[model samples]
Target chain A: MKKMLLFVVLSMTIFMAACGSNDAEGSSEATETEDGKQIVTFWHAMGGASQEALDKIVASYNESQDEVEVRAEFQGTYDEALTKFHSVAGTDSAPTMIQVFEIGTMSMVNSGHIEPIQKFIDEDGYDMGHLEENIVNYYKIDDQFYSMPFNSSTPVMFYNKDAFEEAGLDPENPPQTFEEVEAASKAIVESNPEMKGFALQAYGWLFEQLLANQGALLLNEDNGRSGVATEIGFTEEQGKSIFEWVERMNTDGTFANYGTNGDNMLAGFLAEDVSMFLQSSANSRDLIDNAPFEVGVAFLPHPENVEREGVVIGGASLWMSEGKEEAEQKAAWDFMKYLQSPEIQAQWHTDTGYFAINPAAYEEELAVEMHEENPQLKVTVEQLQATNPSYATQGAVMDMIPEERKIIETALESVFNGGDVDTTYQTAIEQLNAAIETANKARGE
Target chain B: MTNMTAVITQEDQALFVRTKRKQRYKQFIKGILFLLPSIALFSVFLFYPLLRTIYLSFFLTDASGATTVFVGWDNFVTLFQSTIFQQSIKSTFLFVLYTVPLTIVISLFLAIIANEKLKGIGFFRTIFSSTMGISVAAASVFWLYLFHPTIGFLNIIMDTFGLEKVGWLTDPSWALIAVAVTTIWMNIGFTFLILLGGLQSIDKYLYESADVDGAGYFYKLRRITIPMLSPTLFFVVTVTIINAFQTFGQVDILTQGGPQNATNLMVYSIYREAFTNYQFGSASAQAIILFIIILLMTIIQFKLGERKVHYQ
Candidate 1:
């Protein structure tokens, strides 16, 4: 009898241990509101200062009204957040709103699980005229917004003004063209033997931007708007030119290849190992804060012969999940609307280096003052405005963009390793097209 | 009277049999109850996920992990045909080859040195075992700093020696070696601790006998120590091979299987395929393939290696 009792106790202990983990699942589910206010959950990928900005925005929105309480949770990095969203999708426990990166836009659209922001806008008769066209164009498919643009950024040239001055190059006049950059880099390398003249992350985003600036589409069928991109549109000439430039710069001992890691390139710039680099304007604030010397910002350089059209946007946007309760959806939309307000956006832009999606945000007194004090922030806005809105500049909208970017990065690595540029680019395009085809077929598009 | 006595003894025998049966049943129940927790945990965590992975390998899934279409063996066929997958397999083998033996030899050497009764032996043992506490992510980040081409301490030493600065993590030729070095460094602590324990447990009389026989240090190390240490070495080799086959964190953090997929090990590829590309089916198929390969290798290791391991 005693042995049986001990057995039961052991079994009970095991069961209890198993049940312990389920406790965490309790807080994960959307809680029933005790008060009259609707509680809306938000899952975001922002971290550090960006997360702080998000919390501040949420706090302000909560304080402004008692109808809704926004509970913002940091899910992790963009990839991790998307993974979490996908894991919880189609389940009752999914958050009311989720932030997805630019690359995930098409995937979210195709999943048919999103409550398109256009529906809320149409029902509420909200005006989107204040939103920047270039930024809005990215999220719009079939001339309708699927997700609300939250944090947007465009790529530009970042240079060390102190390094430039020390290299006997004009700090105010940063390189605007590839030939000019090459010449200046040569001068910098010669004048300051310790400094590398130029460096760029071996990343596909910069390559895509460079293609966009050349008035070229990265994919076919009007960057996959008219129809799914059946093939990559980066022609051999365009691809080779970009590859050969990197090769030549490397050979000239003027350009440092940071090997596909963005952090390494950022570190090189901060340490003054490189005089200039091409990085996202969103990192402008970080660069400014970390660099010991004065940093110079300029528009990304184009080829000497190619006209500089503009760069595409990089960053994430806010998306609403489907099958959520009406009140939660309404609360989410209200929170999104609050986020898009001029004052809030201006504050976000000043706090984080992300560009304000609403053009009117620049008119905010704080934004204007902040830009005056740090004119480097203004360069990104000018660069965005300078872009001629077109199918090419709108960037690719393929579902396999992340994989495509990785392929291009690998191809770039091969070229840097002295592989033939033409063959490498061709092979990369072929592989990318195969991947896109697979994705399209899987989606039954 | 004797017949009546016999009848009583038979009844007693039957009663004794019944009581023993009841006790055996109770013990059986208790044993099962004790094992139920582990069984349940294993089924939920290990067996179910493994079976699910195999099942999912046959279907192409979308970004949300919902099945879109049945791809059959297409994922496997495609993976087998792809050059990148082929390169990843090659790289994984290269990594195992570079790390496993070197880890064993170096750790064994450290263990032998540490086994000696010397001054500050405890301090040396602590210093050797300290790396075991570091998480892979932390260690990889530290290695990244040390490998930074321009301002890294390694480069500082290279500059002092008038040697050219090598892009340890950037250059494709060196990236794999750099990651292997990091893995070896991180693994040495655990391997050293195991081997140290093994060395301490070795009979002192064997060495004393060898000393009386006029066996030199190297001769005794070869004849006495190695044969005695085979069991520990076998365990270390098996664990190291399995661990090396499953390497992901260092490759992910330090090299990201890049500079031309030089460090693209199997696990990292699986992660990239599933998480980055959202190709769950392909990732699963790749995972199953990795599982089979690791299983076969481990089986071969046990079959061939166990015979050589001396059991005193």
Candidate 2:
């Protein structure tokens, strides 16, 4: 009897331990109102100053309203946050809103977990002209706004003014064309024996930017949207030209490839070891504060043969979570509008070095005043204004784009790591097309 | 009257036995009461999830997490046919190959050194064991930064020595080796402790007998030390192989299976498919294969161990 009792106690202890873990896993799924306020939670990956800015916005909204209170929560890195958001979405305890990266836009749009913000816009009668056309159109799915643009940034050239002067190059006038950039960088390298000529983001964003400027479409059939058949069109003549340029740069050691991890680029740039970098304009504020030397910001260099179109937005947007009540949706709508107000837009842009998507915000006297005080903000605006309605050339969109991106990135890595560019790119094109086909099928395209 | 009294006494004895049985039954019921919570937990958590994964493996789940078709073995067939999946398997085996032997050998060496009656042995043991407390993700991140080709600490040190920068994690050729080195470093302690325990368990008489036989150090090591350490070595190798095959954190955090999929392990591929691509069915099929591989490897290890281990 005592032995049986002991076995029972042991089993019970194991059961309780198991139960404890389950409770931890399942506890966050609870959906209950706190303090009689219809509390809605939001999960986001934005950290540092960007996150702090978002939190302040949320706090302001909470203080302004008594009915619907949004509880903002940080969920870690972008990928981790997206994973957790997807996991908890359908449960009774899912967040009412989530900040999803641009790569996840298509998936979220198709998942039906996100409510169309266009409905809120119509109901609230918000001015359509308040939003920048390119920005609004980018987030739309079949003429419905599925998300709100929050942190839109474009890639631009960041030069160290001190490095430029040290190399006896004009510190004020940065390179305006690819040919000039190459020549100037080579000169800089020769002039200063210690520093590197150029380095870009590890993912080949610089290459893409160059291609975009040269009227090269990354994907066929209007970038795989609008019911057009798709193709991996980046391996065409235009792409080859860019690839050849990279090869020449690498071979000549004019441009040193950073580490496979992006740290090499970031660390080199921050330490003033590299003369020029092609990084997101969102890094403007951080660069200014952290850079050891005076920084010079400029528009991304265009190819001499073609007009400079513009850069694709690099950051995330606020997506409205699905399965929420009308009241919660209304609250979200109000918060989004509050975020898009001229004052908030100006502040966000000033603080984070992100471009304000609201034209009204840009035209605001306060924004102009701020831009006058710091001319670096004008560079991103100028870049955005230079953009054309070339959707195919702008940015490619696809279902399961992140997967296709991984394949292409792998191909890039191979080529950059001394593998044959043509063969590797050809292989990547084939693999990417297969992934695209599968994704399109999944999307019921 | 005398017969009736004898029958009554028997009946009383039977009644007493029945009362004792009831008391025992009550105790048994009390035991079951204690077990009820645990049984409820196991049924709800482990059993339910295992059954659910099996069920979900046969279905095509949509982005909305809705399942559609009952395509039994279709996912597995597709997985087997894909060159990428096959390559992942090959790479996973390679990772295990590099990590398992190196980790076991290194750890055993450390264990022997630690077992020696040398000064500061306790400090070395503590330092080695302390690494197990560090999170794999954190350690991988640190290693990734250290292996960075341009700004990495390794590169800086190499530059100081006038040596060219080595692509520790970037170059395809050296990526797996770099990851293996990191894994071996991180995991050596646990294996060391296990081997140390086995070493301590050896009968001192055997070594004394070897001394009597005038056996040299190498002879004693080959015959007594290794032979006696077989049981622990077998256990460590089996567990190490299992872990090496399941390597994902290092690849994911350090290299992200990059420089052209040089470090793409099976588990990482499975995770990418399941979580990133949301290909739950295919990922499950991969996981099922992994389970089988591990099971077979462990069984083979045990079989081999039975022959090699010197029980005496």
Candidate 3:
């Protein structure tokens, strides 16, 4: 009986420990070396080639400094990194400074756990004017700089020039309208029986880009720039046009559904399973190096009825923690300025396909040589410059945009699976409105 | 003389009752002493968090998981009406049905086959249980390559055979099956090991006695082998069911509950609600519902299935 009792106690303890850990707290002190230099932990979401480039930059920054050392920790994707930030926000476990995506701008501001970059800019007399105008427009809202813009990208359509020549279509001028893209897809299919013509990944970012290209807003109240958005902002025609375009290609037997996985879609294009896709220009370097065939980059397509607008900026920026040592914040500010220098920005722009936020980086030899070798790299910049400065092009600002994105992705997947477009669109609108209302209510206090 | 005798008997009865009460109180104190440590741990970890979840379910929460507004029963009511939540419930049940029985039967079959007195049987046993050591994340990522749409070997095989290529993880009907198949493959290793241990423990004397009585192999297996393994089977069934209901890792790594929410099991939905959407109130409500479900399932199994479980 005594042995049995001991066994029971052991098993109960094991079960108790199986339950998840409470967020650990109690340490609010910052770390300092014996040499009296502060350590600034910088969390980021850049992976692959960009990660390597960032590490090199940090190494250089540390080598050049003596008062503070910055540690760059690569957190997972943007969504995952943001989720982790929220769990440890306002605690000592949080990073001294972190990178946040463009869509998370509003949420990070509302989180009340970050010190606005405007404070440091004012004290340091930093000139935010040297950055690219289009990139600056997306980050600067309500006449204030909440974060320092780092990497920025826009959506552009990639086509197979070899496939175009084979299909008897013009290789120099790619399709610039949705109707022309549909026609091109049909022609490509006619020429190659084994390969599909087009693939639109069931991704939310591409869906948002398509809407912006049609000059449609994502939320009401001036895309939430003027005030908090209350409901859906785009009209029925603007939203349904995107659905109908995909449906037509799908009907023509020219559409390939890669369903929510971008890597798979990219792989399909490289394998010659699909001939065309719309992807971020951030992938330009990798795609050009990997594709076995000639690749061409063009502006994002719009519907034939509406005049062509431009794409929204898709990337991340750096923001400092709300309460940290003044010395640490100053060190981070210095690092941010270092990151925007011509040499570092040129290296970043060349290594990663994210266009340089610092325009002066374009004049650097590294950037100039990369553009000359891969001329397709210039198309993303041209597209960004062409965008009319409006609320729609500036992109929506909301705390619930991530939730809104999931809703849109689900609807797109349904349409790709042959569900009725009208029903899918209707369901998406209802869910999005409900999410916005709930978000507002959560912030009611 | 009669009254004097009656009073003496009543006094003796009163004395006996007093001693019995004292003995009962002493035993109760001893029992409490044995249970003190377990009770302390349970209160700190299990009971506190469970009660906290229940409290959070009745109020809305902000992004940092703080309670912002009070709305009684609203979270539960909204979950019931929400189509996405409804789809998640249906898919979870479907996934459980697809994975549980196949895992048990396949493992049991492997155990029986490897129980023979053949040469090098131990090698086969080790091979059968090899998947037990593979972590869930590694296993899911490996399966992801096999299910890749364009480059996966499975689709290539289908193409060679001239069959219509199936979207293993992209189609609504196939994504759950793909995940279920991956789960069954992962589970067979541990389940096979347990069942094989039970098989090895069964007494050989009974089989010899059956052979002396001219019993056939099928008859002996039907009559003797099954009844002896009942306890082990009962345990494996309960654990597998609970594990199936709590599946989150493979789904997160493989699908993230995509392809029109066809693979959005309850746990993944709760994760998305709480972490990604930052809707803690509704997430807590879902967690509570999942807990009640697993609780009722275990209770029902013990009540109905325990009778047939034979123990030595």
True contacts kept of 1: 0.64
If both were scored by lDDT, which would come out higher, candidate 1 or candidate 2? 1
Q: Which stretches of candidate 1 lie above 4 Å from their native place?
A: A1-39, A62-69, B1-40, B212-214
Across A1-445, the per-residue lDDT of candidate 1 in tens digits comes to: 6876787778778787768867666546645467877888899998876788889989999999989999999998787898788888867778899999988899888878889999999999999888998887888889889999999988889998987887788899999998888898999899888889888787888999998898888888998889878888777777677888888887898988778878878888888889988988878887887889999999989888988898888888999999988988999999999999999999999887889999899999989999988999999999999998988888889778888888988998887777777788778877988898888877754
- Over A1-445, each residue of candidate 2 has an lDDT whose tens digit, in order, gives 6797787779778867887988787765534465677767788887877788778878887898787688889998777788787777766567778888877787677676778777777877877676877776677667777788877888888888998887888989998876787877788788876677776544644565666777676677766555544666554676666555556566656675663566567677887667887877887887777889888899887767777777766678888877777677677777777788887888788877888987677777778887887788779888888877676444666556677667766776666676787887677777777766655554443
Q: State the local distance difference test value for candidate 1.
A: 0.89
- Model 2: chain A TM-score against the true structure: 0.89
Candidate DockQ scores, in order: 0.53, 0.36, 0.54
Best by lDDT: 3
Summing lDDT over every window of 10 consecutive residues in candidate 1 chain A, give the lowest-scoring window. A23-32
lDDT of 2 by residue, B1-312 (tens): 999999999999899999999988997798777777776777788777767777777765655545655678878887888767887888888888888888888888888878877888889888767767888988888887888767789889999999988878768888888998899888987887888889888888998998999999889989889998987887788788889988888888888776678788888988888777776766777877887898898888778767877676
Q: What is the lDDT of residue A172 in candidate 1?
A: 98
Which of candidates 1 and 3 reaches a greater DockQ?
A: 3
DockQ of candidate 2 is 0.36
Candidate 2, pairs of clashing residues: none
Off by over 4 Å in 2: A1-37, A63-69, A204-211, A233-235, A363-370, A443-445, B1-60, B68-83, B118-120
lDDT of 3 by residue, B219-264 (tens): 9878988889889989999999999999999999888899999999
All candidates: TM-score: 0.91, 0.87, 0.95
